[model samples]
Target: MEHSGFLRRWGTLSSFFLVLLLAWGRLYAQTPSTHWSDEDRISSQVIKLRNGITLNYAVQGDPNGPVIVMLHGAGDSWHSFARVLPLLPANYCVYAITLRGHGLSDHPARGYSRADFAGDILEFLDQLHIQHATLVGHSLGSFVAQKVAEQDTGHLDRLVLVGSGPGTHKAGSSEDEVTSPFAKLTDPIPYTFARDFQASTIYHPVPAWFFEMMVGEAQRVPAATWHGLGASISAGDPLEDLKKIKVPTLLLWGEKDSIFHREDQEVLLKNISHASLKAYPETGHALHWERPERFTSDLLAFIHSNGPNP
Candidate 1:
């Protein structure tokens, strides 16, 4: 009886070990391959900078095609361009970056200035060994894009500024729509704060899922980001910078955008000699979010219309 009992116990242990081994094998098989394309990859990458700060970003589309970099506004992540990523031409390689202090990127206590952000972008490109490429920036990202173009025009081919223009905002002024919406943002910011800000500012009605997604992204941002980025905008003067942008420029605005009014676009149009304005009717501050299909199509058309020579 003792011998029989020992045999049963040993058999059970052997079976358990075999099951675990099989499971491990399955998991190993399911792991992503090192040769995966950028389009198939997600923005889970962390890049360490010379300053010891880390930035996060994702890439999509053909690896050899013309590069088009997308930079999101404040309080956003690389996911901001998720909707337009797959819609881009297959012949183009797209890069979406989540600036430091936002998204999965490291949140340093300082270095959130617009110029700092632009420097980070330049370094990002340098690290990747990317030469001239088109730049598309939205809102606050537009400010950073313009800064990069002004500082080094050779790094960019064509520039697209969405919901942005010369910074006419008075420093520390609360009368401006964009600054006013986020003026009261406090540390450990709540999801509700982001929801309320988006609801009050976005001209078109965004779906519930989009609102939730945006709020989720905003909630990840640290309190320092809000204060630091805000101070950067307050201290920045982009009017002169816009005038110096020599690249072919496209300015996209929404007719109903409350944050950036018609007057702002007018000033932008007048200041940038090579810039052209395309206003979307019945749209809001988030024009791309309001009509992503149209936004993607227009972007492709513009980029291809004046694409660099092959």
Candidate 2:
């Protein structure tokens, strides 16, 4: 009887542990990996431009290394590059900026135009004494970078435009009837709208943590800024300005990009003197989010390559 009781006790203990182990395994599977949550690798800072607008930015890599300034898309902050920042080499100093009226940047009553945005960037470079640096911009930021390059190419080493088009709206679109969904947005933008908007940008899967972070970033912008930016984007085309960008330029696009089409890339190439395009297969508008490793590799190759520009 004693031996039988001991056997029963042992079986009960083993069963309890098995249940516990399975529960622990389920918990671990549900939790996001720490690899994607490594925000400690980068440092955040805020700068007040001479125009009195304060902009927030994230910095990473060597301070004394080659300079590279990144501009995020509409309604996004420097955290948009969270995945890409950690992957960059230590030899390059990167400044990923959150544009005015977005992220933690000061949102004034006006000044949402591309020209206004470009002006702030120029002043930012001057304040930091960045005489020459490569500029990387995505979507709305790409247009702003074009303006910056147009206004002054002497301060720039190279230009990279990701998910950009010749213009935000089709030619001849009136400002009042702009084709942007942001124009109709009201204060306290719906969470569903923000989530769906972000979801539409990526064809590939991203970490749940990162996707939620992006949606949160988009929700931070106010309605007035959205209306102002939407109107500004619809009011102008930067094709003429592209002719003025004399620096080596790289246009990064995704094959399945719903925003900018192949024709837009052709127009960009035709205008810029030294420009090349690299299209990612099965990627979408947010190529960086979809394939950050490939994006970083292509960016680094373009920066270091001595190959002739097409």
Candidate 3:
């Protein structure tokens, strides 16, 4: 009887392992290879900082053209701009940086603060010998961009902050707000959960393949990243930082963005002297993903505008 029970337990465990393997294989098969051919898909390399930390970044378009550095939000990688890349003119050089502790970058045990992330951007520009460039940031990235512009006004040509607000911290009680939607992901997050989370957040329908590719890239981010960086943002007061944005700034938000609402935009407009806003109807936090064409057009127009002859 003991020998029979042992055999039964082993057989059940083996069946479970086999089922998991098959499910993984099926999901992998569904994911496409188009990510490799994406116009924004430049092979990434590491930029070593003075402190020995390394940031992974992708560069595309003409080297001599106007530089535009894009920063992605928390729980996301630089691939957030994949669809927007091909839409821009070929003459514009675009650099996308994966913040430390996120994406393929080194994950240090510390240094997930907004100031730390902002400092990385400045150092990254210095290492690349880019004296100044138009800074574009989305969500958490937008908050970082504000800090960069404030660090030195002369180093910024223009600023674009999307799906961002005046304050860095969450509006409610700290204890209850510390959790993230991605808290459930395991160390090596399963692609299915990532896909479901991506689909659930957006108010509009996106192409299935696109969402798959996005979640695949996002899943590569370490689980610690979400908590570390999130805690940093939610613990600070950022109204002072918002006031420091002196460059001509463009604030873009989606009508259906649940994270940062219209009230947040109003607060930002009140704080920043040179800021203006435009809203995308029927869009959510993933405005760039939902309305790529409009995002590209509006961004280009803002970048090209002389802004009252300076």
Local error of candidate 2 at 115, Å? 0.3
* Off by more than 4 A, model 1: 1-43, 171-177, 180-184
Residue-wise lDDT of candidate 1 within 1-310, one digit each (tens)? 9999999999999999999999998887764332234236444576887777788888866778888898998888887776677667767777888999999888988888888898889888888877668899998888989888888746788889998867656754432545554546777788787777666547777666666777888888888888787677777584776788888889999998777778887888888778888899999877877878889988877877886542
lDDT (Cα, tens digit) per residue for candidate 3, span 1-310:
9999999999999999999999998887766443444543465778898878899888887888788899987767777877788777778788989888877888886788888898898888887878457889998798888889888636678899988877556557322242355445468867776666566447877777777767887677677776676577657655876787788889999888877888889998988888899998899888888888898899888877933211
Q: Which 10-residue window in model 2 sums to the lowest lDDT?
A: 171-180
Better of 1 and 3 by TM-score: 1
Better of 2 and 3 by lDDT: 2
**Please, what are the lDDT tens digits per residue for candidate 2 over residues 192-223?**
87898788788988998899999999899888
**Which candidate wins on lDDT?**
2
TM-score, every prediction: 0.82, 0.86, 0.81
Q: List per-prediction Cα lDDT, in the order shown.
A: 0.79, 0.85, 0.78
lDDT value for model 2: 0.85
TM-score of 3: 0.81
Number of clashes recorded per candidate: 0, 0, 0
Model 3 ranges off by over 4 Å:
1-43, 170-186, 190-193, 307-310
TM-score of 1: 0.82
| Candidate 2, residue 22: how far the Cα is off, in Å | 13
Top candidate when judged by TM-score against the true structure:
2
